[model samples]
Target: MVAQYPGMWSGRDDGATLWGKLAHDRFRYMAGIYKVHNWIDGGSGSGHNPLFAGRIEYNFLDPEPSPAYYTASTYYGKAHILAIGLAGQYQVNGVGSALQKGDYKAWNVDGLFEKRIGTKARYDVYTLEAAYYQYRTDGVCDIASSFNNHKADYGNIGGINSGTAILVSTAYLIPWRVGWGRIQPLLRYQQFRFAHHLYGPGNPKTRQFDAGANYVMDGHNLRFTFDFARYTPASGTQSDAFLLGMQMQY
Candidate 1:
């Protein structure tokens, strides 16, 4: 096992990892002018489930812009998903080999798209995203699930095959005014799939609903969001999980 997961470097700037490097100005063509800001996601459970992503936004379709609410022939904004990275499942005890055992590998290849419709008062937004993930499965020596659960799988956590996964999601955004600025609410649906040859290879399907608010503050935007998911195994299992997150971008 090498020392690191993706290693200090993957050799090629754009190797096979799948993380795309796109820019936000790419969306401005449609909204006349839009801004892409940088921000971070932090909270108590932050490191518990680590995720790093670079996103950009562009405003296209707006004809005239003079500060005031000017309605062009059409007002629509586009958001480009530059890159997405994630830290897989965290296992308290497992393998010392980077991704071969303990802790899920932080697979990086991912892509996403976003769109906004309407002017200042009300608008509808939609986003589509996809990613491939390969998490860590407990080694044969471990007597519990790779997720650090109580039960043990006889299949030995499923080996390198355990981490392979494909995920996709779609979301909707609705913006409204509160006191001084505006608040945007978001809803999303997601799906995850296992490549069939992994450990314990069970087919688990999930339904998700996420809601969040975005507030603008002097060129800086602050957001808070919550997500809920219901899982239905393709075979025989019933369970549910939910997550919450907050973001700040300017």
Candidate 2:
């Protein structure tokens, strides 16, 4: 959920960035300055001003030692972990059309705790994670108005950008193996409150729930998931779905 948020970093874009990270003891810090929205579409209302982003984390238990600053949802009982993190992003004239631009800003706080219990031969893994986020655009981009005027792409501001969101999840990995793998059962809840309605007068809140089990064959390298989900949109019918998924990594 955090990665999918409006201002969060997910992957590369049509721009350049100067970024670095630092890790010392139980603390980790990273920051970057970006020259973004350089595409010809001119959909970011961006100018010479750069975007700034940074994150800081503190580990209360075992420190994460990944040199790439990456984190996993579950360590599969390899180690005990407890950590908290805060992140923020900001850019001038980052949202809305060039003629009606707005400054973009976002921030989030998150925490994770994972531990293994019982004897080594029959231990179970427990994980808990949560996060809160706020994203804003100074109220300059009206999505409905932009869509009606065919200016939705004027600044990549057509989606649900200005909102407050939250997520909470818990999981338990049973020690007993099922065939060649172990089972991890998890439950998650998420909610988003939009800053403004997209169409008519109504509550601008969306929610989702997920209950699932993962079959772990080789940690994150190979796994299969069976999930059931329920979703409630801001102004639509509630829906439910079942999913089966497989994941593999080198």
Candidate 3:
């Protein structure tokens, strides 16, 4: 939800951007300036103004040693970590129809903590993560307008507008392995509050809960997940789902 909410990559729209990052043992900073457009419709009236985005993180324990700007959700007991981050985005005339354009702005704060306990040969891994997001637009960029039109206007400007969201997750990796992998039980929750609903007149909110387990063969490189989810929406009937997924890195 955090990745999709702020329109990460500006909804993957085509454009040119200048991005850079500064990383150190104790902190990391990344920022970018983008002149994005809806090239899918030949660029049209998607505006020429630039969009600015950036994120900064401070590490209180062992620093994330990755050279990349992004960090993983967990390190699989490889490192002890305690980190907090802040991120934001802004653009003038970023959304709404051509005649009623509006500015777009979003911000979020997140934190992660991971620790390994027990003996060196049988250490258990624990991880916890949480994030909060707020997004807004100043003009007539409601859900309907944003979804119905995407060529002339940036519209929904990242699939969301004028709302707040939150996500929380936790996981515990067992110290003992089972066959080729170890089992990690996890729980996650997400909630979204929209200032304007896609239908009707009332503000709508949605909540989801997920319980799952991962078979970790080589950390995130080789893993399988089995999950069950339940969703509740302000105006819709409750729904449930079962998901099976796998991940592999070569």
lDDT ranking from best to worst?
3, 2, 1
Which candidate do you rate higher for lDDT, 1 or 3?
Answer: 3
**Candidate 2 lDDT, 1-250, residue by residue in tens:** 3343332224333344443344545777777766543211344443656667777888888776454246777888887889898988877776665566677788999998999998988899999999999988787652332443545434333443677899999999999999999999999999987776532355387899999999999998999999999999877699999999999999
Ten contiguous residues minimizing lDDT sum, candidate 2: 4-13
Task: State model 3's lDDT.
Answer: 0.73
Tell me which of candidates 1 and 3 scores higher on TM-score.
3
Off by over 4 Å in 3: 2-24, 35-45, 142-158, 196-202
Per-residue lDDT over 1-250 for candidate 3, one digit per residue giving the tens place of the 0 to 100 score: 4343333343543334443334456677777766532212322226567777878888888887564355888998887999999988887766555555667788999999999999888899999999999877774353332343543344323344577899999999999999999999999999888766433467677889999999999987899999999999867789999999999987
| Alpha-carbon shift of residue 174 in model 3 (angstroms) | 0.6
Clashing pairs in 2: 43-155
Q: Candidate 1: lDDT over CA atoms?
A: 0.35
- RMSD in order of candidates: 13.2, 3.9, 3.9
lDDT of each: 0.35, 0.72, 0.73
Off by over 4 Å in 2: 1-24, 35-42, 46-48, 142-160, 197-203
